[model samples]
Target: MTDTAPSESTAPQHDALLADLTTIRVGGPAHTLLRPATEQELIVTMRDVWQRGDEWLLIGGGSNMVISDEGFDGTVIHIATRGIQLVSQTDTTLSLRVQAGESWDGLVAKLVSRGWAGLEALSGIPGSVGAAPIQNIGAYGQEVASVLDGIDFLDYDNSEFVHLTTAELELGYRNSVIKEGRAGVVLAVYFTLTASPESTVQYQQLATALGVNIGDGVPVQQVRDTVLALRASKAMVLDPNEPDSASCGSFFTNPIVPEHIARALPADAPRWVVDDEPVADVVVPLGETPAPPPPPKPRLVKLSAAWLIENSGVNKGFRLPGSRAAVSTKHSLAIVNRTGADAAEIAELARYIGACVLSRYGIHLQPEPVAVGVELA
Candidate 1:
């Protein structure tokens, strides 16, 4: 892979408006756009952009981002390449290598169609394979972290490609080293999936939808369809005709807080205790000896952002005075572009909602999307 000019064979139309490129549809224009069609081209293009000291943004399906109305003043690299290959296979597991730009849900659909069982519960997510591991994307109790094998990424500062194992990425719930800006641009990703034809049903909502109990197994395609239906109901799927779908799927992540903080919320508030580690109590017979009690458990809890927002007095479809952006009619977690709103309008609405939640619950809500000059303050 030798360095060269950005390949025109795959470049997006010059200076495409950020609003047009992104799902949120509220940003301004990008100064320059380059879409690389191959991994080598992506590396060379990014290297050239970096060497020139020009600010650059890497975008895939643009589902989880909010750009400024003033637009980016530098180069924007739009990953457009696509490929998926079965890289390795074992008796019980299969490894598939996919380029950065492959659609996330599309990949899941393809895998499920083939009777692969690791990604069925994540069926309706919108984004790219490269972007999935950055946030450790998850849904319905299934996360990209569980299936991720490794990633081929470029180290811009060193102008070299590096292969990173899953452990090195430090994947946690809705986060990873890449999300923290430690890793460079992702060129490709590898996923290891089970050979079984049955998919795991770990989320209660999904299990209920599928008429099954948690921990039960179902056909992978059935799981995928059920997940997709659940997502579409909340306007989570990207559909141009659906006004509520013009926003990023979820504006804020479900807040993870200490157990005490979670306990302070209303009794009916949606909260789940997440155990960071498991400790089995060891019992010793009285005649023999006494074993010391296990160390105190770490108490962490996940709170629903939607619940917090609604409890804070912002109802679904709520909006600030004279604002074009509003909460989605079908989901309180989304901040939709209700009326061709600009980035500022959306940012203002987000701040208002956040303030409301903070004032009422004493807990600040943080946005999940990557903002480029779009201030939530």
Candidate 2:
């Protein structure tokens, strides 16, 4: 890779503290920190670290990570590369390739300004573009998976760069192959956005915020503005002045359970049918007869994690005695660092919340952020 002067934003640092880089502001220092400003530099640096078999971790935006207080023993590469290229455009649709390090909300804002639809409802979500597909980040009713065309990935297993399509990612509710076991890094993301000025609002909260009904079309910019306001009210947006914003967005993913288990919960618990098994279409040979199809399986229900936590006796702003970690004052789904909390305290609070929900509902709540050298148990 060719050497280039680093910008102020991409300059490398020695013995950098991970706490300064992460959103939660609690991780310990890194032994070494490297910031790669270009895609070529990132690849070369990562390959060298891999060849040496040195312990290494990739951090981008650092919004969805929780690192231990003892800190990591190896190199930490902070992705800083940035660029966006419009690959092709038509009257109705356009494709853009974005560098992995591009800010997600920044991209959404740009798209909204350009009258590009599809991502407006996802506004205000934090982190880098490359990290979006790892969890298939979604807000309101729009998810990155819905607009993603593919990604340029650097696979760690074979040390090769390959482009993979959206279907190949096997994306689902807050999950994908990358989050499962496919070891790799996303170098760039490709998105296909509509050229429409307005988008359909699908979420009830969003529709209400915009003073419209669900399924009604509203200006994309209006949708983005309303979503940002809603997130700010819940302290989901990142702001230095907002103490509750010092968190990893939603700490837990909504639990998806079987229909029977959902019915076991108290009435008025918010639950939605996420999916149901499809009946197979049986066909008999030219014999003019067909066998009956099997009955459909039980539907899966997604329960509101915030509602469960509240009902389980853990209310918003709840904190363990003598602990610095507490639930967000505005949103029960988030665990915020209330004044210099250590990673241990945060993990302890998470474990406590999980126990409460499990004891009350028999459903284990899964954490959304990736934990490093720390256990929620």
- Give the number of the best model, judged by TM-score: 2
Question: Candidate 1 residues 168-190, lDDT tens each?
Answer: 88999889988887746998999
RMSD of 2: 2.2
Give lDDT: candidate 1, residue 172.
92
Q: Candidate 2, residue 248: CA error in Å? A: 0.3
The most accurate candidate by lDDT is: 2
Per-candidate clashes come to 0, 0
TM-score for each model: 0.94, 0.95
Please provide, for model 2 over 166-263, each residue's C-alpha lDDT reduced to its tens digit, 9 standing for 90 to 100.
Answer: 99999999999999989878999999999999999899999888889999999999999999999999999999999899999999999999999999
* Candidate 1 structure lDDT: 0.88
Score candidate 1 by TM-score against the native: 0.94
**Any idea how many clashes model 2 has?**
0
Return the lDDT, model 2, position 17. Answer: 86
